[model samples]
Target chain A: SQKIEQNSEALNIQEGKTATLTCNYTNYSPAYLQWYRQDPGRGPVFLLLIRENEKEKRKERLKVTFDTTLKQSLFHITASQPADSATYLCALETNNAGNMLTFGGGTRLMVKP
Target chain B: DVKVTQSSRYLVKRTGEKVFLECVQDMDHENMFWYRQDPGLGLRLIYFSYDVKMKEKGDIPEGYSVSREKKERFSLILESASTNQTSMYLCASGILYEQYFGPGTRLTVT
Candidate 1:
């Protein structure tokens, strides 16, 4: 069976510092991966998507790296602010699964002032 | 911007009652999905529709069913609600890859 794992523990970081989150998978090869932001009591909002062929992608102060060989993806938020606090989710879809998205448990991030 | 809307933000239902959660997307996407979110469990797909009247079972479809009579609307039906069915329900619409999510409905079965 395929499994997606994200750090279940909350990540606390000082404001203006970089926050790094990790996502790992096992027993599956995904064609694409995605990141989403979820505030408390709200649905997730799409943030970024990285294809298997893409090594890195960036938007504003955020960046993502995908290492297919390691079966891991790293999400980075640079110059983070208090407003950047939220739970971040990682999702992926394999070609054999008919493009259905599988999401991780998510890692809650708290940016301290 | 793409918009997906769920019928209710919160709901309370009694066990054994029939419950319906509705979702509508304005983007005219080809795919719609239903998912449930529980603490530490992540998002579990309940069902999905590729087109009107076309449906597929996701990983967790045992206690739920779905209806897609129109392109913009998808409904999840709980035939006989149970306490274990209480959770946050989310609906999403997308094309080939990116998906837009609704605010979600928090259903509580008592």
Candidate 2:
């Protein structure tokens, strides 16, 4: 079975600093990877998607990088604010999986002011 | 904006009781999914439907079943709910790749 791992510890950073979160996977080659943000007691909201062929994708102050060779994806939030505090999850889909996505445990990010 | 709505925000059920969690979407998406979220386990897919009257078992489907009679509505049924089934349940609708999720239902079975 494919396994996805993220930083189990919560990340605390000063507001306006860059927050980086890591997601590592094993035993699977995904065609595309996705990022989502989830606040307390709320469902996850879609953030960004990066394909295997694409190395980097950015939206607003958010950026995601996928490295198939390393089997890892990095999610970055630049110029972060206190509002950016949430649990960030990474999901991926392998070949022929269609819309089925395997998700990581997620890393909690707290941007302190 | 796409909207997915679940029947409840919180629910409490007893062991050996049958439970139903309903989800509705307004985006007319063809795919609907049911998932349970745990503290360290992330979101585990229980079942998914591609079209009307179609369903597929997901990673954790042993104690759950799903119904997709209409395109916009999907229901997750817990047959003889157990204490271990206590968790947050989420419903999602997707078109191609990106999925829109509902505000989850927190279910507690005692």
Candidate 3:
């Protein structure tokens, strides 16, 4: 069976530290992967997207690494702040269409001050 | 900025009642999707539409039906709302990879 997995447990880190989250999948070859941030009672907001050809992508404080061989993606937040605490989700394109995505369960990160 | 809007932030319905959830996007995106988010199940796709009047069943579309009569509007219909259907419903629209999402509607079926 095809499955996307994320750590359901909440990750706690001190402010100004680096936080890393993992997403693993089975039985799927995705063309690209996306990461989103979602707060309580709100919909997810797009953060970054990495294609299979790319190994790493970065935005101001966020970085994402994709490993197709291991079917895993890592999301890292540097100099994390309390305001950065939220549930982060990893999604994979299900087909060549690029519109359909399968999302992981999401991992919550808590950056304490 | 791309914006997607949902009709309600919260809703309550009785069992066996017919329910309709509406979503509209200001961006002229060709692809629109409806998904239900649960506690442990994550986000499950209910339905999606690539163009006006064209719809496709998603991973979990058993009791839910969808309509896309207009390019900017997509609707999800529950023929008979069930208790198990209580969940957060999300709507999104995008041209290809990056999707903009609505605020989401929390529906509670008693």
Candidate 4:
């Protein structure tokens, strides 16, 4: 069985500061990893995704780094704002498997002014 | 843009009632999935469909069933809704890579 864990604790940071989120996995070799943002009472929206062979990927203010050796992926948001306060989740999946995605518990980010 | 639309935002049903949760995707995706989101337990996969009329069980499919008579629609059914089933139900469509999720449906079984 595959297991995925994220920073279960809520990350509280001051507005305009960068917030870093971590995702770790064990027992599975995922070919691709993804990140999503979910607001309260809403479904998750896709943010970024990187393959196992890729080291880093970035989009606008968000940057993601993947280390296959460590089986970890880091998501970073620069100059975070109040609107960025939400639950961010990481997903793990393999190419051999169908399009099934396994998600971690997610880390709640709270950006306060 | 791809859009996944869940039938309802919130639903309240009693125990033993048959519940139907509907989802539709405009992207003509080959994969569709249903998952339950609970606090602490994270998201648990309940069922998935590879194509129209093709279904597969997931990790938590014991109490749930699914239907996909059309390519654009997938439905999750609870034969006997239980109180334990009260949680957020999410539907998603995938394109062999990333998945696009609907707005989610909060179901409460009283």
Compare the candidates by lDDT and give the number of the best one: 3
lDDT at B18, model 2: 100
Name the docking class for model 4: high
- Determine which window of 10 residues in candidate 2 chain B has minimal summed lDDT: B39-48
Q: Name the regions of candidate 4 deviating beyond 4 angstroms.
A: none
The local lDDT score (0 to 100) that residue A18 gets in candidate 2 is 100
Q: What is the lDDT of candidate 2?
A: 0.95
Stretches off by above 4 angstroms in model 2 are: A95-97
Per-residue C-alpha lDDT of model 2 across residues B1-110, encoded as one tens digit per residue: 99999999999999999999999999999999999999888899999999999999999999999999999999999989999999999999998899999999999999
Chain B TM-score of every predicted model: 0.99, 0.99, 0.98, 0.98
> lDDT tens string, model 2, A1-113?
78999999999999999999999999988889999999999999999999999999999999999999999999999999999999999998853856988889999999999
Which sections of candidate 3 miss by over 4 Å?
A: none
- Evaluation by lDDT, superior candidate among 2 and 3: 3
Candidate 2 chain A, run of 10 with poorest lDDT: A93-102
Candidate 4 chain A TM is 0.95
Error of 1 at B30 (Å): 0.6
lDDT of 4 by residue, A1-113 (tens): 67899999999999999999999999888889999999998889999989889999999999999998999999999999999999999998843764888899999999999
DockQ of each: 0.76, 0.85, 0.90, 0.83
Tens-digit lDDT track of model 1 for A22-69: 999998888999999999999999999999999999999999999999
Of the candidates shown, which would achieve the greatest TM-score relative to the real structure? 3
| Leading candidate by DockQ | 3
lDDT of 3 by residue, B1-110 (tens): 99999999999999999999999999999999999999988888999999999998899999999999999999999999999999999999999899889999999999
| TM-score for all models, in order of appearance | 0.98, 0.98, 0.99, 0.97
